[model samples]
Every structure is written in structure tokens, then in C-alpha cells.
Target: MTPLPTTERRPLSDRTFGFLLTLPALVLFGAIVFYPLVGSLTTSLFEQSLVQPGREFVGLDNFRAVLDDQFWPVLWNTLVFTGLGTIAPFLIGFALALALNTRLPGRALLRGAFLFPWVIPGVVVSFAWLWIFNANYGLLNGILFRLGLIAEPVSWLGDPDTAMYAVIVAKTWASFPWIMVMLLAGLQTVPGVLHEAAGMDGAGVLRRFWHVTLPHLRGIIGIVILLEIIWNFQHFDTIYVLTGGGPAGATTTFAVAVYDTAFKGFDLGRAGALGALWLVLLLVLVVVYVRFAEREEQS
Candidate 1:
């Protein structure tokens, strides 16, 4: 057989060197990522206690306990919180992105200000909301009292009816900025000529947006929804700091429940089970996103 050409030899040599260059990073990622993942899975199969020296293998008993107890309610609450939180932020953020994408004055300043909520840490936002929900001297109640909206200050975080809503509002404030930035980036990719062409065809503003802008934004919206779902499902800090899953366990989301079980209740076994359950849910979401992304790629 004829020997390979010099060009082919050089390309193969370069590819080998590139792989060698990336080997360290690949090894580090596996150690940092897969190692913990496998460790967690192994831990989930056993009855472990943070206070104990050894873990007992319990197979599926821990999982069974999780399913039979208040886990169902916590799961339902998590779904509700994630769903509503994701939807509200997407709508509000998309609206804000649309508004800011216009040729309005001081648009840059407004866009920068829009990022303030996202720039603030989740803990800080939670504390701010906690103060706002304070019954006596909170900014919200003070304003309402001054406006004669109520004869007395309302217990925003003290009542089961309003506790979840208060947390949701605070979460929305912190999360909408991410969706706004993503949607704004997507909006910039849309050709202005499409809008001009639609206008020339006598399409109204609403019609143009619906027919032209939305199609271009579909992929970004899908990504935003998926990311929001994942983030909202695992959200703990805001809810923990704001309500501590209080007012009759109204806001006991899965993450909060996991923390309460492991730390407060001292049931590491149950906590591991809860973590495994969330891992399954997150895996399902990942599969869904992968399928959608594959479809988009094919289209």
C-alpha cells in the first residue's frame, strides 16, 4: 500500500496533540463531576447517618418511606412552585425584553437597571422580601397602611395563604432578569428586514410580532423554560430564608424538605432518598430538553 501523504500525516499528528492537550481537563472533570455523582448514587442505596460511622444497606426502604410519607405533598408543592415560577418569569421577562428591544430613549440605562435584581445574591433578595413581608413595619405594609388599603398590616409571610405567593414574588424578582437577557439576545438575532417586510405588507404591530418575531424566538424560549424549570425545582435559599418552609409547611419545596430531613430531622437516609428522587426528575427534564434540541437541530 502507498504511504499516506504528508498532509494526512500532519493532520493526524495535530489531532493527537490536541487530544493530549485536553486530557488533563477531561480527567479533572471526571474526578470532580462523575466521582461525586457515583458516590451519591452509592450513598442513596444505604441507610446513612451523618452522625454515625457506618452506613447500612437498606436497598429501596428509604425510597419507600419517602414515597409513603409527606413526600407526595412536597413533590406536588415543588411542581406548582416550579411551574408558576417559570411561567411568570418567562412572560414578564419576554415582555420586558420586547419593550427594551424598541427604539426608546435611555434604553441602555433601563436594560442595565433590569439586571439589578439578578445581580443581587439570592440570600440578599430573600432577606429583602422577608422584610417586605413583615406585618408591622415592612415597606409593603407601610405603603398599604398609608394608602388606606387595609385597617391593619397583613401577615404576608405568617399566613399559609400568602406565604407561597410572597416567596413566588421574590423568586420572580430575582429570576426574571435571566430570562430578559436571554430573550434580548435572541431578539437581536432576528432580522429587522423581516419586520419591515411585514409592515410593508400591511401587517399590524401585533401581527408582525406574532408572525415574525415569535418564530425566531422559539428556540430561545424553549431553552429559557427548561433552565427556569431546573432552577425553580432546586430553589432553596429564597424559600428557606424567607419562610423557612413555614406557615404550616405551605412552601416546603423538595430542596427545603431535603435540607430539613438531613439536617434538622437528622435522617440522612431519607435525605438521600429525596435527593435521588429529585435526580430522577432532573434526568427526565434533561431527556426532554435533549429530545427538543435534537428536533430543533433536525429542523
Candidate 2:
């Protein structure tokens, strides 16, 4: 006797189940993210002073005014700060990850030591660095004096020339551990077989790292770099606490500029306009990055 034809129905796959489970989260995001974004964009098309009773629709005037002469310096400062800030943290973090990846005495202790900077509150970090970088009698200056490296104290946060760099250093110090932890996790995911194969092929340490480890970490590095760009560009807390975008407005990025324009100047329209521009710029960058990532994945 022949058995009856068997019929089968597949259960919900993991991807579709996950998407369904996250539908509520997606709705929450639409309400929270898109709603405010739309509101801010609408606000940018008007003249809304805090002192005024009414708003006037001025079309692109707010944007035009935002792009006036003073905009260049702020934009340049933001770019430089973001570039240096991103690069320094990544380099330091990658180095830390490499160092800690190998087994050594007190390795766990060393990892925790690096994480201390990251766990501190931003305001506290700012204040701590403020004291350390003081032009007179600070630890750094005192150390320099003891070493006889400088005849005079250097005004790290006081000089416009050095203020942005100072902030970058503080931010890098605070942020590097985040990258290190992430990279270390990625390193653990790399296959040990690959390294053994490379070594068997007569590869040196540098060669194995370049060819085996780096390719394994390519996706993680790309994600980390892109995220750093977004976070560093929008970062406000440390800079706001440390410099307040001062020392001749040397550290005023788009984020700081938005705060100053909105709160200090009380020009909501202009602030909103600047914010809209910022949103557009970030969105463009994200899209380009996503396209690049997709292409890389395809290749």
C-alpha cells in the first residue's frame, strides 16, 4: 500500500517573526522620530522670535540667513573637530583592542582600567579635564615644568588655537573605550583557523593582521566609523560643559550652534532652519554610507 501524500506547512521564519515582534517598536519610532522631524522642518520656514507674539512665514529666508558670512567658521570648526575627534578615538581604541586581545598578566584589570574614562559622566569628565588642563598649576603644566619641556605654561582651553584640540583630546579619551570594547568583541568573532592558516603560509604578525584580521573586521570597522561620524558630529555634552563653544567660538559645531541660536539668541526660526539643514546633511551621509556598504557587501 502506498502512503497518502504528505503535506507540509513551514512555521514563521526567524526574520519575519522578528519583524512582526518589532512592529510596535517601528510604530513608536515613527511617532517619536518622524513627528518631531516634521515639526522642526515646518518651524524652520517661519520667523518665530521668543519675544514676538506671532510667527511670520518667511519661506527660505531663515535658511538664507543661516548661510550668511558667520556660518563658514562654524561649519569649518565642526568638520575639523569631527574629523580629528573620530580619527583619534578610533586609532586609540584600535590600539587598545590589539593590545588587550593578546593574553597577558592582569588582562581583565587592564580592560577595566580603560573603561573608567568611558563610565564617567560627561559633566564630570569636563570638570576633571578642566582642572587638569588649567593654564596655571594644573597637573599637565606641572608635569611639563618638572620635565622642563616648556618655559611657560600652555593655555590649552584658553587659547582659541588650542581649545578645539583640547576638547577633541578630552572627547577622544572619553570615547575610545567604547570602540575598544566593540573591536575586541569583533576580534573574538574572528576564526582562529584563518590565523593558523596564514601562519602556516609563512605570514608574519603584520601580514596576518593586514590580510586575515582586517578583512574579518571590515564590516565592524565600517559600522563603527559611520557611527562615530554621526555621534561625534552631534556630540554636545562634553564640549558644552568644557568650552561652551567658546575661546572665540572655536569649538562651535552645528550642534552647539543650534543650542546657542535657539536658547541664547531666542531665534527659534533660525535654529530650526539650522537643525533642518543638519538633518538633511546627516541623512545624505547615512544614505551614501548605506549604499557604499551594500556595494561592499555585494563585492
Candidate 3:
């Protein structure tokens, strides 16, 4: 009998083959992310003027200057906006998710309607809210005036005390729908049998939610909250359009500060420094997210 011919195989090892498969993505990441990151870090070490020809080596002076002058107030604004933006939307989304998770009339339509804010462009959302919060002819003041809630038009975006809150409200409106969608997906994964068992044991609605619902949703909750915080920390468009970082910089988060420093202030070095610090904070959150995701996958 003739021996069967053996098929020849390529010389590449499995690991090598896998690396080759990922090479394109790695190259893309290098170009789009790593290169710019390195550029920003390098620029942070120098003083460069947009109008001038040369960059001066300043070491960490750029960082020192930012830290000593504008950093604290800006950081405070960022924290307030990010914190309120994240928490308010999260609560509203969670509530909506719970309400819609039940059997209800027009559930699908309601869900679609709730997603309007999330699907709209940030600029458009900013402008819509801009009109809503307008000092003169805004919907908010109009309603308030008719109801006798205010003696006069209130400038929601013009007052430092209220600008951040108004921005947060807009951010919340745009953000909650996404959170609702995520948590709603998580809610679907929950075992209905557990809920029934809890109900059979005479657990109240709030009790079952506190015990069964929350425990089941803990993983998704952490992920959504972290992701929202990261996104909010870098949020700029809403604040920019609605308040332009303020009547007095009340809404200037890190993203806005970086833009204003680079283009408006014409200080590339300081902008780079601010960006580097922003990158660090985001990196820390990313690391935590990666670890949490890994843990979730393992469990």
C-alpha cells in the first residue's frame, strides 16, 4: 500500500502566529495613542510658544506654575462637576431601570424615548440646555416666572454658584440613559427565581431590591460608575457650550482647562503639563477598571 502523503505545516509557532494577528492593532494603538502620549509628556518638559520658533527646556516648572496658580480651583471644579455628574445620573438611571424592568405599558416606547438624550450629539445637547437655562427666554425661567417661583429671570449658566450645577444637570440628562441601559441589561441577568423566593418569604419591594437586586448588580454598578466617572472627568463640550467654563471658570474641568491653556492661553507647555496630570488620573482609573474586569471575568 502506498503511504499517505503528510501535509506540511508553516514554521510559525502558536504564540508567534497570535502576535502576528495582533500586530495591526498594536501598530494602530502606537500611532493613535502611544505616540501622542509620548509627545504630550515630552512637551510638558518644555516651554513652547505657538508664535515663537524654539522650545525652552523648563523641566517641571510648568507643572509647578500650574499647581501653584490655577490647579486647586480648577481641580475643585472638576471634582464637583464629576462627582455630581456621576452620582445624580447614576441614581436617576438606576431608578428608571428598576421602574422599566417591570411589566408596564409602552415599555419599549418609553425606553426608546429615554435614550434620546444619550443619542443626541453633545453639542446639540449643550445648545438645547443652553436655551433651557437662558437667563432671558429660557424654558426654566419661563416656567418659574409663571409659577411665581422666582421674582425674575435667573441666569443659570452665568452665576458661578449655579453654572456647575446647571452643567451637571445637562450632563446628567445626557448620561442617565446610558447608565439605565447598562443596569437594565444587568437586571435582565438576575435570577427571577431568587426574587420570587424572596417575595414568598414576605420580603417587601424595597427589601428584595436591597438584598437580591443590589447584590446581583454589584459588579455592573462598579463598572458603570467607574466608566461614568472617567467619562465625566474628561467631559468638556457641555460645559464649554453651556457656560464656556463659566462666568468665572466654575465649570472648567480638566478637559476644558487643557483646551483653554493650549489654544486660548497660548501656553503649550502648561497645557501639556495639565494633560500629563489628567493622563495620570485617567491611568489610575483605567488600571482599577482593568483589574475589576479581570476579577469579574474570573468569577
Candidate 4:
């Protein structure tokens, strides 16, 4: 046999070339993500006024002020919104996903239709629900009136009591499909034999799901729920467009609060502080997820 041809490796300079290749992306990341983060953090430490003569360094006074004033309520609102917005969808979407996973008629059509709400533009969903929840000439009110459910139209989006829920309902409608799709994908990964085994043990439908299905889905569910929390925590347009944090600011989420504090209140420092706090919360969750994923992979 002929001697094997000698192989020549690429030059060590390729490492530097690879670094240069990734430099653009690093620059872009700094420009968009990291730079703004640093800017926000720096701005939060100063007393920044939108219309005053100059900025002053006030340390954490802006944060103190924010906390002293409306921060508690706003934080509560944000938490509630995040919690309900995440939970309702996770549950309903899981159910819907489970149903869709079965051998049922119109399975393909149902799956496609579930995706419809998620695919629709947020603005369109907001406006559509705005009309549906409208006090006058809205479908929900019209149907309720016809059914004799109420003597007069209810201001679903106007009332402080109902505004958040109304927005939440729209949010749920838009978001559940996302969870459904994710859970459906997670469902696919679960071995069919597990279900068959459970069935052989005479496990009922709910029992099988609770025991076999949920165990496999727990990790995915947790991740999706956390993601939903993050999304809703930063959610802006829907609540803003529909309610504008109206009726005594019942629907004011963290994102809306940040906007109001910065633009409407003209208190950039406080807004920055609030934004920084929000960022820290999100970062913690991200770190947790990354570590968990790494550990899972290692295992």
C-alpha cells in the first residue's frame, strides 16, 4: 500500500481570524443589549430630570422615592399580571395541548386554529378585544344582553375591578396557544410506552396524565411558565393600548410604569431605577434556567 499522504493543519493564525469573525456580533450585542443595560444602570444612580437645568448624582434617592410612592401598588399589579397571565395559559394550554394530542376529529384544524391567536398581531388582538369589551356596541355585551345576563352594558375595560382581568383575558387568549404548542412538543417527547404501562395498571385519564404525563412535562412547564412571567412582566402594548393604565391605574404593569415614570412623569432617574430592578429580576431567572439546563445536560 502507498504511504498515507501527510496532512497539513491550518495555521494557528486561524484562531485570531475566528475571533475577528465574531467581533461584529460582539459589537452589535454591546450596542443593543449590554450598552443600554449599563446606561440604564448608570442613569439610575443619578438624579436625572427630563426638563431640569442639569443632572445630579443622588445615589438611591430615586429608588427610595419610587418605592415610597406608587411602586408597591405597581409592583403588586405587575406580579398579579405576571402570575395570572402565566398560570391561566399554562393550565388551559396544557389541557388544550393534551386534547389535541389525542386521536380526535379535526386534530389538524384545531392545532392550526390554536396557533391563530398567537400568530395574530398584538395590536390587532388588543383592538379586537377592545371592541369586544367595549361598553357600547360590543359583541360580549350584546350577547349578554340578549341572554338577559345583565340589564346594562358593563364597562369591562373601564372598571378598576375588571380592567386588569379584561386585559388578562386577552393576554391569555394570545398566550395560551404558545404554551399549547410548547407543551404539545414536550408531550411528543414522552415515550408512548409509559402511557401504555399506566393504562395497563388501570390508571384513569386524569391519573395517567397526572402521574406519567406531568412528570415528563414538569421541566418544560416550569420553563414555559417562567418565560411567560418574563414576557408579561415586560408586556407593554396590550395594556397600554386598551386601558392605558386607566381607572385609577389598576392595570399599570412594570413596563407601563417605567414608560409613565420616564415620559409622563419626566423622572428618568426613577424610571431607570425601576427598569434596573426589573432587569435584575429577569436576569436571575435566566441564570437559574441556564444553570438548570446545564445540570440537566450533565446528568
Instruction: Find the candidate with the highest TM-score and give its number.
Output: 3
Rank order by TM-score, top first? Answer: 3, 4, 1, 2
Q: Which ranges in model 1 have alpha carbons more than 4 Å from their true place?
A: 1-17, 20-28
Each candidate's lDDT (Cα)?
A: 0.89, 0.88, 0.91, 0.88
TM-score per model over all chains: 0.90, 0.87, 0.93, 0.91
Runs with alpha carbons beyond 4 Å of true place in candidate 3: 1-18
- Report the lDDT of model 2 for residue 94: 97
> What local lDDT score does residue 193 receive in model 2, on the 0 to 100 scale?
97
- Alpha-carbon RMSD of each model: 3.6, 5.4, 3.5, 3.6
Worst 10 residues of 3 by lDDT: 1-10
How well does candidate 4 score on lDDT at residue 211?
A: 98
Screening candidate 4 with a backbone cut-off below 3 angstroms (N, C-alpha, C), the clashing residue pairs are: none
Which of candidates 1 and 3 is the stronger one according to TM-score? 3
lDDT of 1 by residue, 106-184 (tens): 9999999999999998899998888988998899999988899989889999999888889999999999998999999
**What is candidate 2's lDDT per residue for 92-175, written digit by digit as tens?**
999989889998788789998989999988888898899999999788889998999988999999899999999999999898
Instruction: Please list all clashing residue pairs in model 2, or write none if there are none.
Output: none
Give the range of the ten consecutive residues with the poorest summed lDDT in model 1.
Answer: 1-10
Better of 1 and 2 by TM-score: 1
lDDT: the better of candidates 1 and 3: 3
